[model samples]
Target chain A: MTRFLLQRIGLMIPTIFFVSVIVFSLQQLLPGDPALTMAGDEASPALIAEIRAKYHLDDPLLVRYGKWVAGIAQGDLGISLRTQQTVVQLLTQKIPVTLELATLAMIIALTFGISMGILAAISRGGPMDYVARCIALFGISMPAFWLGILFILLFAVKWRILPASGYVPLTENPLENLRSMIMPATVLGLAVSGVIMRHTRSAMLQVLSNDYVRTARAKGLSETTVIFVHALRNAALPVITLGALEFGQLLSGTVLTETVFSMPGFGKLVVDAVFNRDYAVVQGAVLCTAVVFLLLNLFADLAYAAVNPRLRGR
Target chain B: MSPYVLDCIHPFARGPLPAKTGKTLLFAQQAGRIEPRTASGKATAWQSEGPPQFLLDVRDLRVTSSGGYPLVDGVSFTLNRGETLGIVGESGCGKSLTSLALMGLLPPGMSVSGQVEFEGADLLKLAPATVRDLRGDRLAMIFQDPMTSLNPTLTVGYQIAEGLIRHRGCDRREARDRSIELLRKVKLPAAERRFDEYPHQLSGGMRQRVMIAMALICQPALLIADEPTTALDVTVQAQILDLLAELKDDLGSAMIFISHDLGVVAENVDRVAVLYAGRLVEEGPTRSLFEQPQHPYTIGLMGSIPRIDTTSEWLPAIAGTLPLASDPPPGCRFEPRCPFAGDKCREESPDLAEVSAGHRAACWKAPL
Candidate 1:
């Protein structure tokens, strides 16, 4: 298992390298120059050229990419043209807020999705099963941005219960941070809950039909133990896969959610820097997203192997 | 007058069957002995045999699906202490359902009727909660496909000890000790090492041994083995069969051994009940049933067995598959497949009738 995990991680290096090249190409293709955008269109041509040299925008694409990779190797992500702040500095400030929202959303998603799935499986073909399916349908149908706006209107504007949008540092006041994030977190959570629910229900139903479940019942184990102990353990393999995928989605960025909420998260930072042609920030953010995505997948694989002993032992 | 009644449906002790149990003379003899052995073994030894102690008595057991048609109709049999009865039939002949009904383990949505009398308590009459209490305690079952029957993730020891802890109220330490003893009883080598091993770690034969240990841990009075050795090879089959017989002898538990293989059933059981399409068409002592099978289905089954003495290129198989039980015809359940089917056979079903001193067959024409 350790060997498999190491191999997976080793393969990630080349993958990230390729992805970084693609990110650089996309940044190059975006309309408008970073130096011009930073210095303004009316600035003298000489000043623009100096700004270009300052940000290494004057260099050829290959030389610039090489220097960028070297700086990345030395843990320097360079400065954003839009903000004039180091890419790493911007990330360090915004990461805690994004992580908090994503983690909260993931927790909500797992709780609601897993419980609904178990209920649906246990009460298969009954009303509860249909209800869970309908919930999945409704959740997946609505766009996260639209859902976030709807929540804002209903809970924030009309109810006067929550702030409409924007983020607060959790350390200053944990309560307000939580209250502010609830709407966006819920919108994001509801988006992925459908996938989790569907997977859990199908996996659980399949596991419930296994011969060992019958054996457990024949042993006079109550229905609760038979389902939770015998069936759920086997069902956990797929749930882990779905969970990891969803968690990776959460971490890489919830773009629409942060935009609607006006939150300064990694997702919003990436979007703002992209439009402004802030090469360094976009490059740094993409790298972070790729590394986190790969790590989440690796974590999922390890969890899966742990649950299914046959995989680990073999 | 003969001491035994001639026409009674006793599946064991082939002779003039006693008219009824509790005659004063037989009762006095049992009272004289401080302890008695297995009913069949003791009955074989003493000239004066008392009323046999019944371990399980199922009467007119009928299982119907939610659609209200009978899946298993009018199946009845009695098991005596330490006696072995083999229920033999092709797949989907209600053989497994009969055993499941006895244990109250029928799949949901299938309705079952008729009395399941075990230890003088009518099991069907008992509430489901009571039946649950009896399961893995007084009545236990081990299914075919030991590969799939055990929980894969749990240790063999945990599966065996589950019943001991739940029903017997043994603590973790005591249950562990009892589990090891059970493994040893099933003749699993290195019981201590095997106790902690998971199902995948063991071979097919060893996993089966673990299943047996799980079933027998509670020392149930009646054990239903549904083709326990069908998945095993010849050598492993014989080993498992021998282990089962030894366990039955030592534990004094009545066994209903269900199998499709005639050889496994013939060697292991004292009596045989042949089912076709949810009906017991013929039943008698194993010897007579094999030699002079009166019902055409039973006769056909006997002919299908491959014999070493006969050099026939093909062993005759009972032609055609079992008819679907969804809508049974209004005659003998086996009439569609029976080559000996007469007009009467197609017109009416036959109830069990005495063909000899003890053998009973459900057929229109007997002693064929």
Candidate 2:
């Protein structure tokens, strides 16, 4: 098991290297030159030259890449031209808000998605099954931004129960913070719940038909144990893989969700940086997102070993 | 008169039939305590007495799908304590379903009816909860495909001990010790290590042994082995069969051994029940059924077995496949495949009739 973990972690290095190369190279093709964008269109040629020299714009692409990589290795993401702050500083401020939303949304998604899925599978072809399917359809089909707007309209505009838009830090007031986060998190989680529900239902149905499940029943195990213990664990293997990928997607950012809620998050930071041609911030954010995805995948592999011994050390 | 002579006197006998005298001979051979009762004078006593008590008495047990199509129609047989009864048929002939029905493990939406009297209760008439309580406690089953029959995620020891924990309320430590003991009894090497291993870590034969250990851990009175050796290697198949027989003898558990292999059934079971298209075609002591099969279907099945002793270039396979479960002939289910099938065989279904002492066949023309 230790060997497998080490091998998987070792594989992430080249992946991060490739992501960095791609992000750095792609930032150069955004049409506007970074130095010109920083210095305003009406700026004199002298000002432009100064800005270029300050940011190493005269250096070759390879030399610039080496410098950027060296900075990253030293935990310095350089300064954002638009914000006039270190890229690391911007991330530290935005990451907490986004992490809060993502984690809350994930908890909601897993709780509703997995339980509804199990209910639907157990009472197949019954009213609960159809209800679950209908809800899944609503979740998968409705756009996140639109759903957020609907929640805002119903809960904020009409009911006047919640603030229309904005975010509060949990450290300031936990209650108020949760009140602000509920709508956006629901919007994001609802969409993911549909996917999870569908996968869980199908996987469960297949596992329930397996011979081992019948053996479990023959062992006089209660229907609960037969489904939850024997059937659900096997059914969960595929769902776990899907869940990790989904969670990774959540952690990266939800642009539509953030924009609809007017919340400051990683997606807004990354997106604004791209338009402003803030190369360092964009590269740092994308690299971090890629690293998160890789780590989540590694965790998923480890979880598979824990759940299924056959995959252990292999 | 011998029990066989009394059995032959009953015309078109259906429902519960007389006990086989061969059972006594078998008990004598196996236990060596009960003297063989082959003499006519001793058999005469059995003939005059009331029906002997049966450990399991199934009467007209039928399983029908929700659409009301009969899957297992009117199959009945009785088993004595510690006696092995082999149910043999081709695939999709309801051999497995019959066993499943007995264990109350029928697939959902399939309705089962008729009497299954075991341990002073009709199993079919009992509430599902009661049946669940009996399952894995009084009645246990070892399925055909061991690879898929065990939970791959659980340790073999945990799975084997599940019955004791669930039914007997044994604590974890006690259950674990008992499971390891059972693993040793099943002849699995390194019982303690094997108990901790998952099903995938074990070979097919080893997995089957683990399954055996799981089924026998509770010491169920009735053990249903549904094609337990069908998925094993030829040599491994023999070993598992031998192991099962030895354990069953040691445990004194009455077993309903379901198999398609005639040779295995002949060697393992005391009595043989031949099913065709969801009905019992022939039933008798294994020796008599093998040597003098009265039903044409049973004869056809026997002829289909390829023999190394024979020099015939072409093997005689049964002429046709089993009749579809949805649509069956009104008369004999085997008429289409029976070479001796006549007009009467196609007009009306034949109930089981005594062909000789201790032998019964469902055919219009018995004693053929």
Candidate 3:
């Protein structure tokens, strides 16, 4: 098992390298002069030249890429052109807010989504199943940004219950943080919940019909025991895989959702960096996203093995 | 038992019918509804002939889909203590559904009618909670395709111990000890180590042994084994059958062995009930059913099977597939497939008539 985990980690190296190359190339291809953008439109040509030289903008692409890769190896994300702060530090400040939102979103998604899915499958063809199906359809159909706007209108403007835009750190004030996090998290998580609920329902339906479940019932297990214990353990495999994918999406940041709420999350950081032509922050964020995504998949594989012992020994 | 209570009646209603068209035979529905179990159920006391000898007595048990099409139509049989009754049939002959219906494990919304009287209580009318309590502890079942019957995710030990813990009220330690003992009883090698292994880890035969261990662990009064060896190879099939026979005799538990294989039923079971197109066609002692089989469908089944002891140039198979349950012929269900099907057979179904002291066949030309 340890060897298998090691092998998976080793496999991610090439994928991360490729992702870094793509992020770097895409930054280089963006139609703008970064040095000029850093110096401002009104700056003299000589000042742009000075900024370019200082930042090694005149170096060969290979040399610049080599430098970038070496810096990545040492945990350096390069310096932000405007703030002169390291990209790593800037990301660290914003990532927590994003992480908090995503975590809450994931919690809500899994708890409600998986339970709804279970209920729908167990009560199949009943009114509860129909209601759950409609909810899933609604969740899937509504766009995140549109849903965010609707939430803002209802909870903030109409109900006078919440702050519609901007975020507060949980450490600053737990109550305000929760109030701020609820809307965007709902907007970001609802669609994923729908996806999870649908997958969970189908997976559970398949598992529930398995002969083992019948055997469990034959063993005189309560219907609850048969469904939740014998059935859920097997059904959980697909749900875990879906969860990993949703986690990757959340960690990468829901850009449109972050933008609407002015959440000052990693998503907002990346979007603002794109507009300002801050290649360092964009590249750093993309690399971070790749690493986290791969790691999460590895975590999912481990979780799958944990849930299913057949995979563990193998 | 009293010759016949023959009556021509409509299926939807009771009492005598016009007898104008066909539809003469009616396997009378057992009259009585076991009221819902209440705290005062003991006061009812089941109004019995003092604890009937049969461990399981099924009378006219029928399972129908929501569309009112009977999947298992008017099936009746009795299982006495320590007697092994094999229900032999081809696929879709309502063999498995009969067993499932007995366990009250039929899928939701499907309709099941008829009395399943076990231990003085009408099982069909018993509350679900009561049935659940009875299952595993008193009435157990082992299904076909051992490969699929066992839970893939659970360990063999846990699967075996689940029944012991649930029904037998054993603690974890006792459950584990008994599980190992059961694994040993089923003749699994390294029973202690194999107990911790999952279904995939074991061979097909070994997995079936695990299934047997699970079913027998509770020492159930009745065990319905539905083609328990169908998924195994020939050699493994023999081994499993031997293990099952040995375990059953030693445990003294009644068995309802449902199978499609004639050889299996003839070899292991004492009595055989042959089902054709969801209806009981013939039932008798294993020797007579195999040797002097009365129903043409039964004769066809016996003839079609290849025998190693006596080689033949061609096995005479029953021509035409079994009829669909959705639109059954008003006459005999097996008439279309029977070589001796006549105009009388086409217009009217036959009653389960006594051929001898202990043999019965549902055909016009019985004891031929």
Question: Highest TM-score, which number?
Answer: 2
Off by over 4 Å in 3: B1-52, B309-311
Q: What is the C-alpha DockQ of each candidate? A: 0.49, 0.73, 0.64
Q: Per-residue lDDT tens digits of candidate 3, residues B57-143?
A: 899999998788889989888877877888988888989999999999998778899999987799888888989999998889988
Q: List the residue pairs that clash in candidate 2.
A: B4-B357
For candidate 1, lDDT tens digit of each residue in A106-199?
9989998999999999999999999999998888899999988899999989998999988888889989988998889999998788889999
Across B16-43, the per-residue lDDT of candidate 2 in tens digits comes to 1123223322322332221122212322
Q: Write the per-residue lDDT of candidate 1 for residues B50-133, one digit (tens) a residue.
A: 876567788999999888878899998888877778899888889999998888888879999999889999999998878888
User: Candidate 2 or 3, higher DockQ?
Assistant: 2
What TM-score, over all chains together, does every model reach?
0.90, 0.92, 0.90
User: Which candidate ranks first by DockQ, i.e. highest?
Assistant: 2
Q: What docking grade does candidate 2 earn?
A: medium
Model 2 gets an lDDT of 0.85
lDDT of 3 by residue, A96-157 (tens): 98889898889889988999999999998899999999999999899899999999999999
Query: On a 0 to 100 scale, what is the lDDT of residue B166 in model 3?
Result: 92
* Cα deviation of A263, candidate 2, in Å: 1.5
iRMS for all predictions? Answer: 1.1, 0.6, 0.8
